[model samples]
Target: MREVSDAMGRPWTETGRHWWVPAVRGACAILFGILAVVWPLITLLTLVVLFGAYAIVSGAMAVYGAFRGVHPRDSRTWLAVSGVLGIAAGLIAWIWPGITALALLVLIAAYAVVVGVAEIVAAFARRRAGDTEWSHLASGVLAVIFGVLLFAWPASGALALTWLIGLFAILYGASLLLLAHRMREAGRRGAAGTAAHAV
Candidate 1:
């Protein structure tokens, strides 16, 4: 794994300045998941559009976060890469709205795997830098597992696939929400500490 920083380097928690970014992303995921689950009979075109929108939004947030923070360069790079991948996936979906179920499945799986790996990498960087929380790691693990499961069952029915994606999105969103909450709390604490020190 690439080293995020040396012993005196900034912790990943420092990136929490924009906790709302992940919060928004998480909310989007949950909303998408809910729609998928509630309307299992949704049309292929609708699903494609919804997914494409979600990916683009999620990717935009990630890219925004990457540029908005003063975090480590490596961390920003990972996020940027993930963001770009997501954007690419979304664009492909939009450009080819008539893609086959199998093709869509493959695309989704690939996006999840790549993004999950990036999250995992970022999580390790956080851990190494003295952040002690499992939310990020858990989110990454769930994403990876979801991706692998989809790949393993490429022949699943459309309805089954919808439910699977819904469940994964819900779980992933919940994890991100947890991470945002934790980061917000950490940021507050940091601010309070700084004020106390100044006083």
Candidate 2:
């Protein structure tokens, strides 16, 4: 019983089995973005609540993928760490909803940096494992850029920040959705090939 592999010699099952995780994360991000944009005048408390919900949902999905998705051990570790950070950021936002703008800025900045780095690491791990899609890498790069921008513009008004965050979320969510689609396609191809080989 020879194992069927992808073009890069990694098992196809590993790449195709968990397409929904990113899809869920992406949906959450896009929803959050829409809300942020639609309600640009949202208060600190509202921002906290909205962001908290998005982070927790996204993080939870990442954690689930870390445990359930087929991947290299290193990739799983990074993904798990990213998920935990996201959850922690959300919890912090909820627990301290009244935190000053500066505080929230710093917190969001830190979370973005940590998650971005983790994502980059995971992307490389997947690449090493023979996954050809660059969406994951692009996502990581985008995250890093977003984090840097947030940090560099810490004094930006809340309204500006709100718009920035919204734009970032939309872009990030779109990338994740693309990745998910590719993953699903890869899975389908793998399944078809496996069946044909068996026949």
| lDDT top scorer | 2
Output the TM-score of candidate 2: 0.92
- In model 2, where do residues sit more than 4 Å from their true spots? 1-10
lDDT of 1 by residue, 1-199 (tens): 1223324455444555778988998999999999999997888888899889999999998888778763345566787889899999999999997798888998998999998998888777666665666787898899899989988995764456899999899999999898888877776766666678799
- lDDT value for model 1: 0.81
* Model 1 per-residue lDDT at 135: 83
On residues 63-177, what C-alpha lDDT tens digit does candidate 2 reach at each position? 9988875455568889999999999999999999788777887787787788888889988877766566688888888888888988899586555698888888899999999
Best by TM-score: 2
TM-score against truth, every candidate: 0.91, 0.92
Number of clashes recorded per candidate: 0, 0
Which whole-number lDDT from 0 to 100 does residue 159 have in model 1? 50
lDDT accuracy of residue 7 in candidate 2: 39
lDDT of each: 0.81, 0.82
Instruction: Give residue 117's lDDT in candidate 2 (0 to 100).
Output: 88
Which ranges in model 1 have alpha carbons more than 4 Å from their true place?
1-14, 70-72, 157-159
Model 2: residue 124 alpha-carbon error in angstroms: 0.6
TM-score result, candidate 1: 0.91
